[model samples]
Target: MLFNEEIQRVFKSDSWKKVNKKLIGKMLSEYMYEKMIQPNILSEEGENIEYSLQVSESKHYHYIAQKRLFDSFDVKWTTIYIVENDGRKEADSAIELLVDLQDVIGMSSETAGHLIKEMNSTLIADAHLLEKEAKRSDELIHEDYASLEGYMTGHPWITYNKGRIGFGYDDYLAFAPEQQKEIQLSWIAVHKDLASFQSVEGLDYEALIASELSEEERIRFDVKVKQHGSEPSQYYYMPVHEWQWKNTLVQNFPEELAIGRIIPLGKGEDRYLPQQSIRTFVNITNKDKHHVKLPMSILNTLVYRGLPSERTVIAPKVTEFIKGMAEKDHFLKEECRVILPGENASMNVNHPYYTQLKEAPYQYLEMLGTIWRESIYTYLEEGEQAITLAALLYEDHHHKPYVESLIDQSGLSTEEWMEQFFKVVMEPLLHYLYQYGTVFSPHGQNTIVVLKDAKPHRLAIKDFVDDVNISDQDFPELQGLSSEFKAVLRTEAPEGLTQFIFTGLFICHLRYLSNLLKNNGLMEEETFWSLLADAILNYQSRFPQLEERFKLFDFFKPELTKLCLNRNRMVDYGYSDDDDRPHASEFGKVTNALAAFQLNRTVGSN
Candidate 1:
C-alpha cells in the first residue's frame, strides 16, 4: 500500500478530473441559489399598468460549500451564467419551475444536503479503514517475503516460485540412494502411524530416483518409508494432519548453506514451545548496508516470533512509545494516535480465558504494535512526544486541558474572549455531543484552548475517550475485565452511569458554556433555561433510553429551570464571589432580571 501522500496525489491526478467536474457541477447547483426578483408596478390611483422588471442574482450562499467543493473537486470553471428577463412575476414563476426541474432530476436542495452529509461521513470512515487494511497487508507481505528469502538462501537446490516448492536436478543428485533410503527409514521410525508398512516387500531407491521404478515398487517404497521416514520428499505420502511438517522443515532451515546440526531456538524455561532449525549461511552480504550481515533463515524466525499477537488491544506502553516517536518526528496527529488495545497482546491456546475472550493480552499487544509501526507511525513525525502521551492515554482519549499557555498570553477583554470561545470551541462541542452521544467535552483537563491574537480560536480535546458501554450482548469483551474495573467502566448496566453522564454534561459542557456566557454578559437565567431545554430536547431524540431511565423530562423540568435561574441570579446580584446561598428575595430579583432580558430581546427584535 502507498503512503497517504501518494494516495492524495493519485486523488488529485488528471485521471480524477472527470470525477471533479461532476462533483463541482453538483456543488454549484446545490448551493448557488438564484434569487429571482419580480417587480410589479402598482398605480397610486389604480389608473395605469406598466411593464414589470425582473432581476436575478446567482450568489453562492455559503463560503464553506464553495471551499469544500473546490478542495474536493478541483474544478476548472471560475464563473457561472446568470440570465435576466422582463416581467417580475414571470421571472418568479420561471425560477420556481427551474427549482422543481432540478428536484425532479435528483439535484434538489434536500437531496444535495443529504448527499453532502453522507459524502463527509463516507470519506472519514473510508480513510480510517483504508489505513488499517494497508498496515495489516504491509506487515504480512514483509514477513512472508523475508521468510521466503531466508528459505531460498538455505536450500538453493529447492526452487520456490509463486509460493510453490520444487526440487531441481542438483537436489536430486546431491544425495546417494543409500543415504536417501536411510533418511526415509529414519523418518518412518520416528513417526509410527504407518505400522501397515511392515507388510511391504522390497524398496527400489535408485530406480525411484531414476523414474524407472514400477508403480508397485513406488507404492511399496512409499508404504515402507511411511513406517520409518526421515528424509523430506514432495512425493512422500502423509496424512493431512502431518503436512504442516513440510512447512516446519523449510522454515527451520537457514539459507545458502548445508544443514549441519539442529539447535532449539529458546531455553527450556520460556513459556513458548522450542523449535529446532538448521543454520546454514555463515557469511552473506546485505545490499542495503555494506557492514551488516544478511540474516540467515533460521535467525529470521526469531524476529517473526517477537511480533505482537493479533487478537487483543495493544498494550498502553507500546502505543505510547510509538506515538512519542511519531510526535517527535512530526507525524500527522489525527492519523498517528489511535491504538487498538486488543490486537497487540497474545493468548495462551489452552487457557480458559482464551476460549471465553477469544484473545490474549500479549498477542493483542503485538498485533497492535505491528499495525502502529507499519501504518500510523508512517504518517507521524519521526519523534513526537505527544504520540507517547497519546499511547499512554489511549483508554482515556478525552481527558485533556481546556486552556493552553497561548490563551493566557493573549490579552483580550473577558467579553471578547468569551464570544470567540463560544464560537470556536463550545459551539462545535455542543454539536458533537448532541449528535454522537459523546459524554466527554472541553473541560479544564480535557481540552487545550489555544489563543491567537487575544482570542481563543483553536480547541483540541486531549485524551478523548470515545469507548462507551452499550449492552452486554452488544459487546461481550467487556465481560473479560475484572468486576471492579467493569463497575467503574460500564456505562450501560447500572443507575450510577446516569450520574456519570450528568457530571459530564452539567459539570463539563454546561459549566464551560455558562462561564463563556457570563463573560460575554449573556448569562441571563431565562437564556440559560432555554439553552438547557434545547439541549434536553435534542438529546432525547438521540437517546430514548433517558426517557425511560430517569423520566428526565418530568423529573428535572422544574429543577433544570431553577438551576439556570439561580445561577444567573448569582451573577446579577453583585454577589458573584459569594459561595454561600443567598435569600429567596435576592434569587427572585435575579430571576426577574433574567426574565426581563429575554422579554426585551424577543419583543425588540420583532
Candidate 2:
C-alpha cells in the first residue's frame, strides 16, 4: 500500500473530478479578478452569474460565479464551458485554460508553456488530496493539531498555490505534504572552507547535533567522517533535502566532490513531515526538535524554494532582536501572548560561481542552506494544541467547518469565539507594527493559533528573519538591532509595512475564515469584522503612550493596496532569470472593509 493510502485513493477516484473542475473554476475566477484578464459578464441573477474571457478571436472560456467581497468570485466548476478558436465547444482542461490566456495576460510563449507544466503538476498532486474523502471539519477539529494540518487544501487566496514545478510522480508520493510521509533527511559534511554556520549564543553546532541525533547515531556519523579521512572539526554538518541532494547538489558540485570537500554522510534517523510550505519540514519523530527549513530548487508558488546565505546566517539575530522586544513589553508578553519562534541557527553552503554573481538570480545563491526554527510545540503550554490558522477554514467531505466544532467545544457563542481569536492574533500583530515598526509575514503557513479547551489561547508566529522585516525609518525600539541583521532585513514605509498585515494576514487568510463562518451560518460577516475592529481598538487603548506610533503604522486606512499574487506569478517573481527566485507581486487597491465600521468608540480613540 502507498504510505498515504487516502491521498493515493484520491488519484484513483471519481470524487476528484469535481475538485478538478473547482480548481479550473478557481484559476479562471481569480485570474479575472486580479485583472490579468477582463471578462465580459454575459448574465446575472440573484446567486447565479455567468462570464467569459476571450483568449483569441476564435477561442474563449465561460463559467458561473458566486460574487464575493473585493470582487472575489467562487466559480461553479460544473458550469465551466470553453469554445476553442476552431469554434468547437468542450469542458475546461487545465492546460487548455492557460494556452487560451497566453495573449490576454501578455504571457510569453516560454512562460505560459512552463506555467502549463507547473499547473499540470499541481493539479495531479491536488487530485491525490481529493482521492480519499476527508474527515468532517467538525471531526477533524477534535484531532491533534499536527495531524489536522495534513488535510489543508492549499493556500486559499493565491489562485495557483500548488504549483510545485519540479516534482515527478514518485517524488510527489515521497515528499509532498498530501502524502504525509515521514522523510529521512540526508546529512552532509560540507568542508569548513566552503560553508559557514551561525547559531544563538548558547546553542552551538555540536549541541544541535546532540539534541537531534542519538548518542549512538552521533558516534556512527562522526566515525563515518573519520573513515572518509575527514575530521569533524574541518566540516560544517548540514542537512539537505534528499531530492535536492540527488538531483541538484551532487550533480552540480563535481569539483568539490573530487576534492573531498563535500562529503555525503547519508540520512539521519530523525524523521520529518513536510509542512504546508513544502520546503520547511517539521520534526515529527521528536516533536520537540527544531523544525528544519532547507532549500529545495523546485518552483513552488511564487518563488524557487531555497535559502539565501545572507538570510540564513543572520536568522538567529532576527529572532533574538524581535523576541527581546516582545518580551520587554508587559502587555505583549502577558495579555497578548504572541509567540515568536527563535530561528536559533543556520548553515548555508554557497555555490563557488553563483555566489560571485552580484547580479545573478537569487535562487542560484540560495540553492543550499538549512535553518533551525523553534517549533510551536516548544511554546505550547500543557493541554494546549497549536493549529495553523488556515486549518480553521478547512472543510470536511461533509463541508463542515473546523471553527464550528471549535466554538461548540469551547462553550462560547460563535461571536465570542471569533472575538478571542481576533484578540489573540490581531492585537499582538498590530502592537508589533505600531510600537516597534516590526512587521512579520503572518500568512496562514507562518501563523499558528494555540487553542486551550477549544478557545484560541495564544498565537505562535514563525518564518523569522527572511519573512520578517522592519520599517526603513527605524523607530527608537530598533536602536538595539545589529547593523549586520538590519542590513538584510527589508525596510519600507510604515504604510508599506501594513501590507505585511493587510495582504498577508487579512486578505490572504482571515477573508476566507470570515466568509466561511458567515456562509456556514456560524456568525454574521458584520460581527466578524466588528469583533476585529474592537480587538484593534482595545489593543490601541492599552497603549495610549504609543499614539504617534499608531499614526505612523496605520492599519485603518480607507483604501489599501490589494497585492496581486496571481498577477506576479504570471509576470516576473522578484527578478526575471532562470537563476533568480520569485517574489510576491503587488498591484491595484482594495477597500479596507473595516474602515467605515470604526465601531470601537467604547475602547479605541482616533
Instruction: Identify the leading candidate in terms of lDDT.
Output: 2
Q: How much lDDT does candidate 1 score?
A: 0.26
**Candidate 1 regions off by >4 Å?**
1-411, 464-502, 505-557, 560-606
**Model 2 misplacement above 4 A:** 1-16, 56-60, 83-90, 572-575, 578-580, 599-606
How far off is residue 491 in model 1, in Å? Answer: 4.7
Instruction: Write one digit per residue (lDDT tens) for candidate 2, span 217-251.
Output: 77777887898888988987788998898878987
lDDT of 2 at 155: 83
TM-scores, in order shown?
Answer: 0.23, 0.93
Candidates' lDDT values, in order?
Answer: 0.26, 0.80
Error of 1 at 570 (Å): 29
lDDT of 1 at 372: 13
